[model samples]
Target: MALKILVTAKRVEDPESKIRVRPDGAGIVTEGVNYKLNPFDEIAVEEALRLKERHGGEVVVVSIGVDKSQTELRAALAMGADRAILVRHDGPLDPAVVSAMLQKIVEAEKPDLVLMGKQSIDDDQNQAGQYLAERLRWPQATFASKEASLESEAEQKKDPGVVLGADGRSLTVVREVDGGVETLVLALPAVVTTDLRLNKPRFASLPGIMKAKKKPLQELAAAALGVDLAPKVVVKRLSEPPARKGGVKVADVEELWKKLHEEAKAL
Candidate 1:
């Protein structure tokens, strides 16, 4: 069955890059920081591509950020997305605002499925997918993964954890839960959030990268979408964790217990 899948690609600070809080505590120091596509979102894009490959269709990747976000969109295009859309906005964005913006896009695109990372690495808010689902009043399956397939490398690479119903009107999702995995059958036009074990993202080949330059990338202003960008949640400050103190060697378990109970008070 043919499908139109919409996936999100969020540009975030690369975890490997050195991150320092500004003196004023407004935000992180962006001077020399590096940026890349959010790893979870990369997995979402990979899943979308895999779904398209299994059941012939088109995959559309979208991002919301400054003009630089086009770089991430192009990266998704290079990974075999049919096209891209970018919502241009250079301001503070919270999960509420993002979900509102995505709602507008969903209304315009009307895809059969909306796929996104469970959360962005920079914020780690992990709320956008659920917020979007609620706003759209659609069924949702989050933390998608297949524990059984994950045990075998070959199986992990070959099979998709998310399975489409034979009739093509429902989805069978194997997702991670508190103690184990949980399965859910969601009707079509649902939202799904990807987890790390979903599928390994494919690297863009040289030819793919070259072709991506020529692919269609539509850019739209966030204001044009008519979704209010005012963030409901605001960050008051940013601070680094306190430095850890050097550990002291204890003579015995009794000493360790004494330190834990009296000094550390961790007991």
Candidate 2:
């Protein structure tokens, strides 16, 4: 049976770029920051593509952000998604708002599965996927990862961490937990969030990049979705961590202990 999978592509500041909190405590300075698809979401897309390859279906990638987020959506297309959707919304959005928006999309698309990153690097809230699953009242599996190393040859040849059951009515997922890993079997039309070790995302080839331009990329206005976009959580301010003090060399263990106890008060 063919499956239709919905994956998410989130635009985030490149981790390599320097992030600076604005002087007014408003937000980060985006003047020179480069943006890229969130790493976890990339893994999710890869898993979706793999599932499509195995089960024979379409993979649709979606992004919610400013117009520039189309860049990330196109990137997902270049990586092998059948199509893309860009939900244009420019404003502060918390997990609640994002989940609500995604719920509307999910209803419209009616995909068999919703795959996305466990968390976005920028916010690292790790709540959107869970929130979305709760709002949709669907079974959810998160922090997906395989036991083998992602770089290992065996892992490269193995099936995706998220496996579709033989009946195609359920999904089996291996997910990371607090101390180890856990497995879960979810019924169809469930939500799954990818972890770092799920899969290594493939780069877009030159031909793929050219082809992505011709792929169907539908744009939608967030307001028209009829979902309330009111933010339940708000960021009051942003601030940088305090600078670390220079380390002092200790002449002896006793001196180190004294410094730790008195100067640093670590004791």
Candidate 3:
């Protein structure tokens, strides 16, 4: 049987572009900003497509936002997702609300596995995946560097390599830890969040883009999902980071050492 994988993507400001706080300090200035798929979320989409390719399954990509998110979802479809889903709303959504809505989608889709970026580049909360797993009472693996699975006792000694699953009942994944890696064996219907090293995301080709235009895309309202959207936390203000002053130059090593030891108090 083929595995069913659901991946999550989000629209975010192009990280390369500088972000500015609104004049009133209410929020970010988005009037003329460039928006793109979150880099981490794109990695999630790529990983889902790869899993579908390797295991012969369907890959579904979903995003939450206003109509603008449709473009990002279409980008994922162009990268080989079978279908796309857009949950429509026109305001900022907190991680909790995002997870709650995702829970509803998970229950509705009933996919065998869910793949999502470890965190959205815009908010960097890193909470949605974990929250969704908890709300659904399913196993989860986050910050995964690569795929893995623990074999059943009968197959434990067979090999120590990239095993997708053992007994077709559970999955083991390798997570990037502080200094090395950690392995986790999670049962089917699990959540896995991707990190930077997961894989390089592919760009949509000309042919793929044309095909994506005809692919199936479903739009659903947040109200239809029956999830509350009230946020627990509110953004008080948005501000830019402090700028650094130019550094002073020293004539030689002695002068540098003196400056470092005395002025900068290094020694």
Candidate 4:
């Protein structure tokens, strides 16, 4: 039987967009900002596509956001996902709520695996994937990096999908750790959060883009999922970091040394 992989692709601000705190500090000003798929989530989609190509599977991408998130889901489909699901929501959501909603979807979809970004760039909370995994009581692997060493390129290519559990129903994941790298073997029906070096996401060719428009993109309401969408955390204010101070240009090494020793109080 072919594998059923469910991936997540979230809508986020363009990486280059300049964001500012709202006037009332309730949220960030999003007016006139460009929105795109979260970068890490794009990697997640790419990994899912690669796994499907290697293992013969169908990939389904999903997102939780407003109606505009349909565009992100379509982008994932354009990259070769079989279909997409958009959990339409317009208000703020805590990671807990998001996880519960995802759990409800998982119960309905019953996919073999769930792939998502290690963190969302917009908020950088880095909690949704872990929380979702806990809610589903499934194994999880995050910050997917490269294995420590591979004797051959082919071995490296095969590393991510290596099966080590009963009846070839497991996956071995190599991910980055604090000082070195760590490897883990997880059973099937696990959650995997992608990182930067996983794979380069393919651009949507014109043909692919046209085909994506015809692909299945289903929309569902959070209410339909039977999970509370209310935020657990309250945002009293939103603020940007303080402006960086200008640095002085020393005329020579002597001046630089003096400034470092005096102004910076260095040895």
Q: Top lDDT: which candidate number?
A: 2
lDDT per residue (tens digit) for residues 7-66 in model 3: 997999999878898889888888778999889889888777766766678999999999
Instruction: State the RMSD for candidate 3.
Output: 5.2
lDDT of each residue in 1-267, candidate 1, tens digit only: 988999999999997999899999999999988899999999999888888888888999999999999989999999999899999999887999999999999999999999999999998999999999999999999999876555686555656668889999899999998999899999989999999888788899899899999999999999999977889988999999997888899999999999999998999
TM-score, cand. 1 vs. native: 0.92
Largest TM-score belongs to which candidate? 2
What C-alpha lDDT do the candidate models reach, one value each?
0.91, 0.92, 0.84, 0.84
In what order do the candidates fall by lDDT, top score first? 2, 1, 3, 4
Can you write out model 4's per-residue Cα lDDT over 1-267, one digit (the tens) per residue?
Answer: 467888888999999998888888888888989999999999888778777777778899989999999989989988889999999999886788888998988898999989999988988999999999999899999887654334557444643433434455887887877997788988888998887866566787888899999999899998999877779887778877888899889999999999999999985
The per-residue C-alpha lDDT of model 4 at residue 22 equals: 89
Assess every candidate by TM-score. Answer: 0.92, 0.93, 0.90, 0.91
Q: Candidate 3: where is the Cα deviation over 4 Å? A: 147-163, 249-255
lDDT of 2 at 114: 97
Instruction: Look at candidate 4 and tell me the lDDT of residue 189.
Output: 89
Q: What are the runs in model 1 whose C-alpha is more than 4 Å off?
A: 151-157, 247-267
TM-score for candidate 2: 0.93
The sequence of per-residue lDDT tens digits that candidate 2 reaches over residues 5-50 is 9999999999999999999999999999999999999999999988
Give the TM-score comparing model 3 with the true structure, all chains together: 0.90
Tell me the spans in candidate 2 whose CA falls farther than 4 Å from its real position.
249-267
